[model samples]
Target: MTALHSSAVTDGDGDGDGDDNGRRRELRVATLVAACCLALVAVAFVPAPVGAGDNIASFWFNPEDTEAAAGDTLELELVASTHGDLVGDGVDELAATLEYNSEIFTVTAIEHERMLADGDSAVEIHEHEEIDEDSGAVTIEQEREPSGDGARTTGPMATVTFEVASDAPSGNETIEITDAEAILISDYPQGTFDRDAHVQIDGSAAAGASDADGVPGFTGIAALGVLAALALAAVVKRRD
Candidate 1:
């Protein structure tokens, strides 16, 4: 009778041990799945660092031109396709133009305030250079600092903005802007304008179209898509 009772107790202990091991295995698998899901979520939501190929070949001094007027504040907003702190390094050149009387009017300005998209900090370039031209093409070169803080920092993306006078030429003139000889240090592709990117004159507010054979405008949709894909991956991983 004692021997039989002892066998029964041993069997109960073995069963409990097996149950505990099974529970532990399940817990570990669950933890791994949760971690993978979280990683995917982070990747989906996090915006990638902008690169040189993503740079805008051209943008309007006044996109909508809602308030373009002679003697008025001609607000020139540069809509660069690429936006990041690292853009500063890849920028090889910069140019701006205002068309008038069948001729193009180009201006030169200094790039200032290397601010981030989040507007948290400003970067300083080691070298600031500009092209010397009144019309046609202009080039700029600068040495940009790398990203991150302290030692072992990564490269920074080139970022720049220009401020031009609103006193544009009149009488059938078109204000054209182009980024001349803009080089990218990254492995991605680079581009330039052929005839130049133009904004119509005659005090009319309209969006400028790309030149016949020029690089198309950069949109934020690609980045958004990447994020979405990452999110989907995370979801699938968790489900698995």
Candidate 2:
């Protein structure tokens, strides 16, 4: 009877130990799950970085949105911004192409701005401007002659003069930067962004409104559809 009792006591102790081990394993699993959840939540609250680099250079028209009358002449300033920090390099060269409705407007002239010169006339700037009337495209290229450290400022790269057609109808027209690129003083390619400009012509009668299909130019509704589709495609592509 004594030996039997001793065996039963040992079995009881073994069962107790097994139960304690199971409870410890459960606690460890719970702790690990909680830690993972907290880490995910913290990441969700963090803001996304704008760009990989310290500086995010961008190009856009001075007056992003403006109005012009038929037969009017206006100047559009193509501005570049280099959000340069202590560690970021500056812009030394730039190239861009502007697209517009050929029938509605014409490119008269284009001149370089002082931004590339760093506001110093002693700094020479080489500029080239070409107008393609057939396609309504204006190509602009500018470089600092002696691109040392580059200009770390924001200002106009070129001032484009446009002549509105005599009989342009009242509507919204988009001036888009189809292509653009920039180079830093380090000779490495710099990240850049471009924005489109909008010009609203105020006139009751249509001046040069006709597409190749022999129909009227893009109405506000048509333009909105195209713009929305383009924006959506861009977003989707970037996401991919």
**Predicted structure with the largest TM-score when compared to the true one:** 2
lDDT of 2 at 148: 66
For residues 1-240, write the lDDT of model 1, one tens digit per residue: 455343233335566676667778999999999999999999999999774465334333324343333323333343333321255433422333323222233343444324221122444445444544544344333433443331111122232223223344333433345443333434333454333233344332221221223444334666788899999999999999
lDDT of each: 0.41, 0.81
Full-model lDDT, candidate 2? 0.81
Per-residue lDDT for 144-228 in model 2, tens only? 8787667888889899999998877778999999678777776666677899999999853544333233545546669999999
Off by over 4 Å in 1: 1-73, 83-122, 126-143, 147-170, 179-189, 192-240
In Å, residue 118's CA in model 2 sits off its true spot by 2.3
For lDDT, the strongest prediction is: 2
TM-score of 2: 0.65
